[model samples]
Target: MIDTIIFDLGAVLIDWNPHYMYRTLFTDEQEMKDFLATVCTPDWNEEQDAGRPLREGTDILVAQYPQHEAYIRAFYDRWEEMLGEPFHDTVELFRRLKISGKYKIYALTNWSAETFPVALARYDFLSWFDGIVVSGVEKMRKPAPEFYQILLDRYHVDPQNALFIDDNYRNIVAAEKAGIKSIHFTSAGQLEKELEGLKLL
Candidate 1:
């Protein structure tokens, strides 16, 4: 039987996008897109999530893109602005799951260590997780079998009886390899349907 539920934080439970902060900085949408695509790209951001210091990451980008120094720095300077709001529907579903007393709820997220504390302080629902594994804190990230194993071993969770939810297909595939069932989350409504179908909701 499924006795554990794991949720990915960004995009699944929280709405976070660089556009939320970048749009106000650049008048030309294309310019912002180019900066995000070429400079502070997802891969670069993932480095921070993997435990590289934020300052170091920002400095490297600033040195490489001297012309866009301010923009590069602003990526983290106003990082909290990138956070939109919690997905209320998803949060409600999570709340229901939590109070159901039927499964252990946990979170696994690829977020910077420096900024994660801000999220912890801002969102009360975050405290509801029985446990959380943060990439930055752990210095490891998803799609890597070892990282998922850490969570499984640490929690003594049976991969066969646990379900993982994430917005990233790559992570979903990795979860399957770890022997954990997973949902490639797209929307809260779809998530609810899947859970209900599994007799979880």
Candidate 2:
């Protein structure tokens, strides 16, 4: 039986658009793409999520591209704009699950401390979760095995009794390898079917 549900924040609960922030700040697409490729890559985000200081990351970016130092800072400052609204129906589904009292819901997200509060302020539904595990605060991230182990240990949940949902295939694969049941979320409809298959509802 699935007694707990772990959810990824980005692309699952809230939409993220790298292009949106780029378009908003830079008039030149090539420059924007180049900067993203070199400086704002996933590795940088991961480092930031793993408790690396934002100012240090910003300093590194500034040192790399001296000409766009201010622009880069502004990009980080307004990064929250890149995250769009929450997925429709998912919030309602979460509310339903919360009221059902059949499963414990927790958020396990690869999010930076710098950006998480912005997300929390933007989405009130975030407050509904029983527990929240953010990579920045935890100094760990998904697919690392330790991240899932921390959640399992903290909640006293058996890996077999937990279902982790994430938009990233790698995260789901990692959770599965850790002996936790997982759902690779593509859409609300698909997630609903997966839950039904598990007889969770």
Candidate 3:
């Protein structure tokens, strides 16, 4: 009886990876790993994802790790290089759902507010989403119960009739905690099968 579908943007649909860009910046593979782990860690990036200004985040990181200033600046300066575009098979399913006119399709993503516009401009299919709740825009990222509530409240989405798909297990857990059905997305084919099993495809 699900009438709404929520999709996580990164990993699930968009193949966004810092490694894609970092591969060019550092010649040493171990150094790249060390830099990502210690200098520009995921925790640091998540703060930006939670509505911190990109410029401010970049400057702070630069000051904290002065040795990595160039690399830190490159993270946002050449940000688009990280985008690998949308997964075609999953997008095909989304388009099918759209064409059927039977459900509300939405995007719930934890992306930086400043850099997200680049994606909107590059991906035409983004326009097809009935609604989008960006963590950066809301100043709250996923895995937080309040963030999910915002999506439910703002969109007036019926929790019982919604199906959430996210590549991150933490986000999936949060969605389930909010009383929405969820899928820990892996492949496009797997998602199609899940939708079929739900009789939503």
Instruction: Point to the candidate with the largest TM-score.
Output: 1
- Model 1: residue 118 alpha-carbon error in angstroms: 0.5
TM-scores for the candidates: 0.99, 0.93, 0.97
Between candidates 1 and 3, the one scoring higher on TM-score is 1
lDDT of 2 by residue, 1-201 (tens): 888988898888788877787787789999888888876777887888888878888888889889878777876777877888788677667777789899899999988887889888889999999889888888888878999888889988898889998999999999999999899999888888888888886
Assess each prediction's global lDDT (C-alpha) against the native: 0.95, 0.85, 0.92
Candidate 2 pairs with clashing backbones: none
In model 3, what is the error at residue 105, expressed in angstroms?
0.5
TM-score, candidate number 3: 0.97
Backbone clash pairs in model 3 (N, Cα, C under 3 Å; residues 3+ apart or in different chains), count: 0
Candidate 3 segments exceeding 4 Å error: none
Residue 23 of model 2, lDDT score: 88
Candidate 3 residue lDDT tens string, 1-201: 889999999988788989999999999999999999998889999999999999999999999989889999999898899899689888899899999999999999999988899999998899999999999999999999999888899999999999999999999998999999999999999999999998898
Q: Give candidate 1's error at residue 176 in angstroms.
A: 0.3
Candidate 2 regions off by >4 Å? 28-31
Please tell me which model should have the higher lDDT, number 2 or number 3: 3
After superposition on all C-alphas, the RMSD of every candidate to the true structure, in Å, is: 0.7, 1.6, 0.9
Candidate 2: residue 131 lDDT (0-100)? 87
